[model samples]
Target: MQSDSKILAKINQTVDRLSDPESYDLVCHEHRLGEPLPSTEKLAKIVNMIREILFPGYFGTTSLRPNTIKHYMGVYVDELFELLSEQIMAGLCFTCKNPHEVDMQERNRHAQMLASEFIAYLPEIRRKLVADVDTAFVGDPAAQSQSEVIFCYPAIRAISNYRIANQLLKLEVPLIPRIISEMAHSETGIDIHPKAEIGESFTIDHGTGVVIGSTCIIGNNVKLYQGVTLGAKSFPLDEDGNPIKGVPRHPIVEDGVIIYAQATILGRVTVGANSVVGGNVWVTNNVPPNSKIVQFKARETSFSDGAGI
Candidate 1:
């Protein structure tokens, strides 16, 4: 008991020191105010709850009937709206930071409105996501059905999270979009920044190690294979050699572009429409429309037909 009390005392002292303005002045200047929310697990559950509601029988309790499903969804939607409203309000308050002005009521109203708007978009999102499911099905042979993809595929999981996060981002709610994507990242090993403009009919095949960075503008019907990275080859660095923040650093893949496995197309370069970028290729320059890039003379062999020493 004595040791526990001493440990608690030490933790309190450390927290107090951290809370001191002077002690944290330099760091605080670099970072700003953002009140922490519930854990990512909690957020993930909320997201999954939303998914279960949106796509009935695909996620969460599978035993629900079509009749009872709406009732369950209404309950989940209410709970999600409540929790998301609180989190969004916290985000707004954190970002407002005026200190002299804190309008919690107005922020709450806006948050509620945003939540309502996001809920309204669910049907359209589902419609677009159906196209994604079709793309995935036609793109990959292993997928049994749309139901299988919805229930088991990481690509679907990641895409679902991205769509949800993208809607929140469009609503201009800060921090939550990134958190939602990072949750999908943790689950699926695919890192798609919420700010990346991805179009409908997008599919990620065998999605592990696929990274779509911020500023990546993906057009419709874009398909990416595993280990493909649409990232910047080089960042515009500051005087201190740190990469400049918020620059357009990723590729803009035009519509109908197929990026195969392990292909790294970097920078603000535009991959023109109907292009096929093959595996293990590093592309920095702009690819012309309908261009096919593949490995050349990369394989080595020794002839065994000749009678040699």
Candidate 2:
């Protein structure tokens, strides 16, 4: 055991190191007085509340039936509005250059308006989620029912979160949308950027190690397998050598396209409608519509063929 004096000295030194201005200058979050930063934990609860609202019996409180559903929805909607408004305001204040320069009341009203707009879109969001659930059921032979897809599928969990976060991003709510998507990403091992625009009737099979980049526009009825990467080919450097931001870096996957496991489709290319890209293929160019791309046959090797080269 260390001596008490040694422990105090060590703690003091650690605190001094942590508090050094140079150490924290770039990464520390700065907020104004009386302004609340977005809370990841609270945002997580909000995501859960959304799932509960959308799925009803499958997600939370299965005791609810047809007769009592309306009352439960009303209560959940009220609670969601309150929670979402606060978090949205927190996100706005967090991203503000100087919170004091803005009028607090108008900002609060704006947050309320955005929150109401999001609430209005919830039914549509739920409708799309039903399509996703049905897709998952049809895509996976192991799925016993649509209820099984909702109850047992991690893809549904991740995709539902992406949809919610995408709508939040569309609403111009800032940091909170990324955080909400990341909450699902951490749990599901599916890294879908909240800014990615994925359409209806999408499903992923065994959805581990899937990465969808921001600016990716996925069309309807698309299915992707595990270990797929829809990523940028390379960054276009600016005059200062920093990569230019928001220049449409990812792929535009058209309707009914299927990218298989470990396939790498990069850049702002288009995987044309109804196309299928085979597993382990590296695609960096546009694929024509209705094409099926697969790997070439492996050549047989012999000692006389100089295969070592």
* Best candidate according to TM-score: 2
lDDT by residue (tens digit), candidate 2, 162-242: 999999999999998899889888999999999999999999998999999999999999999999999998999999999
| Pairs that collide, model 2 | none
Candidate 1 lDDT score relative to the true structure: 0.85
Q: In candidate 1, how many Å is residue 288 off? A: 0.7
How many collisions between residues are there in candidate 2?
0
Error of 1 at 60 (Å): 1.0
Q: TM-scores for all candidates?
A: 0.85, 0.96
Full-model lDDT, candidate 2: 0.93
Q: What value does the lDDT take at residue 163 in candidate 1?
A: 89
Which portions of model 1 miss their true places by more than 4 Å? 1-38, 62-64, 237-244, 299-309
